[model samples]
Target: MEELLQQLAGKLGIATRFSDGGLVRKDYEVDDAVVRYIAERLGYKAGNRGEVEKSLADFEKRRWQQTLENIYVVEQGKLQFDAVVPAEQAQSFFALQIENKDTGIRSEVAFEVHPTDETYTIGKTIYVKLLVAITNELPVGYYNLTFTVADKTYKSTLAVAPCRCYENPALADGKIWGYALQLYSLRSERNWGVGDFTDLGNFIRMCARCGADIIGLNPLNVLVHSFPENASPYSSISRLFLNPIYIDVEAVPEFKPEDLSEIADKIAELRQSELIDYAEVYPLKISVLEKLYGRFMADRGSDRRNEFRAFVEAQGDDLHKLALFQTLYDIKSTYIWGGWTAWEDEFQNPNSPAVRKFAEEYADRIRFFKYLQFEADRQFKQASAVVAECGLKVGLYRDLAVGVGKDSAELWSDNDLFIRDVGAGAPPDAFFPAGQKWCLGAFNPYVLKERCYEPFIKILRANMNAAGALRIDHVMGLMRLYIIPDNGDAGTYVMYNFKDMLNIVAIESCRNKCQIVGESIGNVPEGFLETLAEKNIYALSVLWAERKDAGWGDFNAPGEYPEKAFMSVGTHDMAPLRMWWFGYDIELMHSLGLMDEAAKNDTYHKREIDRWKLLSALDANGCWPEDNLRKDNYIYGQGYPEGIEEAVHRFAAKTASKVFLAQLEDILHVEKMQNLPGTDKEHPNWRRKLPVTLEKLEGDIAYIRNIQAIRRER
Candidate 1:
């Protein structure tokens, strides 16, 4: 029974063990209950030994009977694939035809199958290596493959991609620096409470004036519009679409600022608050948008109307599906209550009769939702255009979140691709001892491969079209994911076809002329960083994580940093530089009951030492401010001297890295983190607004001086 379970697990792509960053391997013994639960979810009867044996035999038979995979993706320099053929048919001639996806050009080759020495008894099959070496045959693009054997014809997709991702040409001149900020955190006098597309355009122009080439942003994926208070850009409803809330309502052609007289007082109140009140902001914007949408709908023969129609047609089914999902969600929340999970079984499937009926009845509402996306897309592009106009090199760097929420619209639209009832998360480590479950859906590796990665490709193309570069959050998921089943405790890792995934990324990167950066921060697997470097994917290097020795106080000098990396002082998940230097996070964690007294005391002691060591490292790297004191004379409670934050940013800028980034919070000397990882509503995560508005920031001496120093150092 145990042997049968092992065979089944192997076929399902579940890892029996995994090694940590330290190269210490730990094996997960086959647990009967966990195995049975996961198997049942995957549509297998694993209740008893006899059923398990049948499942294993069936899986093996299906795999052995297959002649070739549905899709074959290979790198440019290496082009080869294996074919499973009957021993008697091994000597037969096979005809191969390849047609380019973009161009209608076609090529053909004829060859005999050269079988390997080994043979499988399941179907009396032999492995044959079919090396495709044609004179100028395949380039870095997708192709339609046709293979013929005797009278039978088989079809599959062939993707020949570059081995490495696209490299920005600006890097050859010199290193470039940028500022990373949450878009909603930006404050402008003209905005309706929260930051909008107009603010983004203005901010981009301001950064360019300081000679910064890049502007990194938090994920702008669509979230639950009905419950706007449930805000966290990372936990989005649909990654393939843009968030409509970021649209600049007043900037719309049909919008009139004088029309907002009824809600003028509400907008002013929201802008005055220290934090963004999303609940109020969402409704206020919608009320004004509905008025503008009405005006737009009335303009029958206008060019803008035709443009919207053309956009709808170009977006096709993906836009329609998202609009439908949002419309359904709105009705469900109003009457049925809860998310899509609470809907009737007939309405669960997008193609079901009930859903079709609902979509038809509410077609106008769905069209309204689509209009929201249209405006959002239009504004986002306008903001992105500001990058080039301002002479920035690598402009508008966007972020792609790791996964979607469990009850996300993505799951509702296509349930088969997601492994329902399972979650993707981190294993127990130094910080999270009990382990963490993010409550996000894990992708079914089998389904993704079977679908020829169409879903994944669509997501890449969507985000890549709007930015000069894209940062994939938790890029390690391309290799393996720590999956925890709903019924199990800490679960095991599930491996993926990482090589094929990276090849696809390369194809998309080159096609869009966008560079790629992988966030490889915590609990990294062995050789992962090296693999990222080889593939031309920049690995993330946090300032705090770049230590030279065992002691936390010993930091790496600027020269020690890797050239192929995205260097930053901190991320949205960690404390800002000012907070880290002051040990404010330690105090906050202790007050939140996340750390005990002993742990708090020990962490504070180390933090004090780290403060001094950081200054010493900066001084060694020629980044320390002349007026700052680095010795013991600098007291903890007395606060850091002027230009301390700028010096920290300058330290990162002086690194050997090609791309250096400073958080906007750090540049403005904000002490709070944009988010605390574990806590959701307990801590005000993703709600804090920038203390300084864009109008003031444009002329603020400290802001200009801080950004200029980074530009100079780079």
Candidate 2:
């Protein structure tokens, strides 16, 4: 026991104390063993000794609890787990390694591998070969292997021998070959007040027509069934599973005609509404789904049941544990921000036998949760396939939020990884005078470095597997995060190391084969854009933000913007061009305190003149005669006159950016912003539904032609 403690202490590079009372390194002394262990884990050879030593020394000096916050170090092709330790306790350790004798070198580590073939048939066994390079020689022994691929986990064994190749044929192609992202309310039809898989599949078919290769969706991570307030997908209760709300109740095999009729009136009520009311829809859908589940159980030998079982098995123990946790969470009704340490002593210790026994007792509930995820995955894949059949190049580019909720599954499962005391947010910037304090907990820098960034890799794979392209919200976070210390004000925070973070991001991007779009909109550090460019990650160019000055202007000129970017007029957070032009109410703006009376008057007058000039130019083109223009219709509101949508689109089309994204709202001529910043219930945010249904949207000739024209020119 003393020897084991010494070895661990040496490897951890910290002073070790055995149960019998023995110490390896002094409390304040540098732990060489721990440093060596970290260095080896990071794949740095003797050549990097000096740098590793320096880093260890720095770690000791900086006693910040959140040391390895968001740092990613991939060694031997695998992300290293965080190796946090007191600087004085740095030390060295050894890992059993397997080398390839044929090459007389270490085998390459395998992070992830994708199928070379673009398409495959269902029920066909396919073999995919992976190459891994090991960094050290190891004693002959057997090792257990655990890997997650395509939302499925596979565990196996590898015998220590000289081998360069690791082949996995078990991960063969399935019936669903594509991935789709839920556009949420962006879809046209069959959305029971909110976008569901039905609408997603229809959109996928449209993508097929457009020649799109793959589709990606936002994190479909599950949320509590009853909570409609938490709209962000990243703040999920379980990262290992899927959100049940996305389930297409009618599509379930067990759904009966009579059950459907029972909910017909409720369903009809939902169809008439535009915005998604999850509180109402979720309950109604769940009631119908429960009925379906009963039928599914009755027909045990059915194909759907078998599929569900396979999915449950594939997800393994993780899903079961999370589901149980969710059940517990609901029953206890604990506050999200309340520290987990405060949970009843029995519930707090996740690994205790008692908890395990409890989880087993509630196995049925766990299975149900797993069943929902499996179905959601199936529907999402089918939707993606529909998109691939379309003609779009990148079918569904999903967005990944910067961090998860503090009380999320990630925090619960890996409490040590996140700093519960501190919150992650943005520093004071021009857009926001007060530093933003997002409630999400950030990974401790020190802890992350000690662990070698395994958590980040998990997140990356989750988003990458099903995406053709990924929009990293607040891409600048990869470089530096503003971490507000626990028990501190929003302004009390520090920055994390940037270079290390970028390296991991670059590697992940290469491995995924998915285009990366960094949302580098605000408070960007110097040379950050250049760095992202060098890494082959594209930038996000908003038409509103592309002007030479902060004021709005014609920004589509080629020389003005980066060529490799996704150009958009506005996003979900901003007002639609039409709304900004025609409906900028001064009273509302004043009430929101966006501007003072004097400043508002001056700005309003300047914008009115600018609108007149633009309208005059349009009238000169004879598109609309000067006399034909109705003064009332063209009246200036807060900023611009009506009829600015055409100009905005034209400007966006002409930009140097390779990809152009016309907001669904703009296309449908929606008047309201999907969400408003600063205020929540005061405004109708994420709740507004699209005015037109999916069927109507498809038949909207004008809308189709306009988008087609833009794409044609691109």
RMSD of each: 2.1, 13.7
Candidate 1 global CA lDDT score: 0.83
Q: Compared with the true structure, what per-residue lDDT tens digits does model 2 show for residues 1-714? A: 234333433433322221111122211222344323333333332224465455444433342332232322333323233323223222222122224323445433433222232221223422222222343444322234343333433433333421111111111121111222335675444555677877777866755654333454566667655466667675666555667788887777666668766667777778777666777888787777766666667887778787887877876666766766766665556454354545677776667776788778776666666667777888877766654455555666777778877767667766777755566775555445555777786766557766655567567766765566777888877765555544554422223456556656655655555677888765565588888776667787776666544545533353476777776777777877666665454445556786689867876676565555445544543333455555444546534333345544555565667666666677667777777776657666667776767677657764665555455444
Report how far off residue 200 is in candidate 1 (Å): 1.0
- Compose the digit string of candidate 1's lDDT tens values, residues 7-50: 77777777555544432444345456666767766666678889
User: Which clashing pairs does model 1 show?
Assistant: none
Q: Quick one: best lDDT, which candidate? A: 1
| lDDT by candidate, in order shown | 0.83, 0.57
Structural similarity to truth (TM-score) of each candidate: 0.96, 0.72
Q: Indicate the residue-level lDDT of 130 in model 1.
A: 40
Q: Which predicted model would earn the best TM-score? A: 1
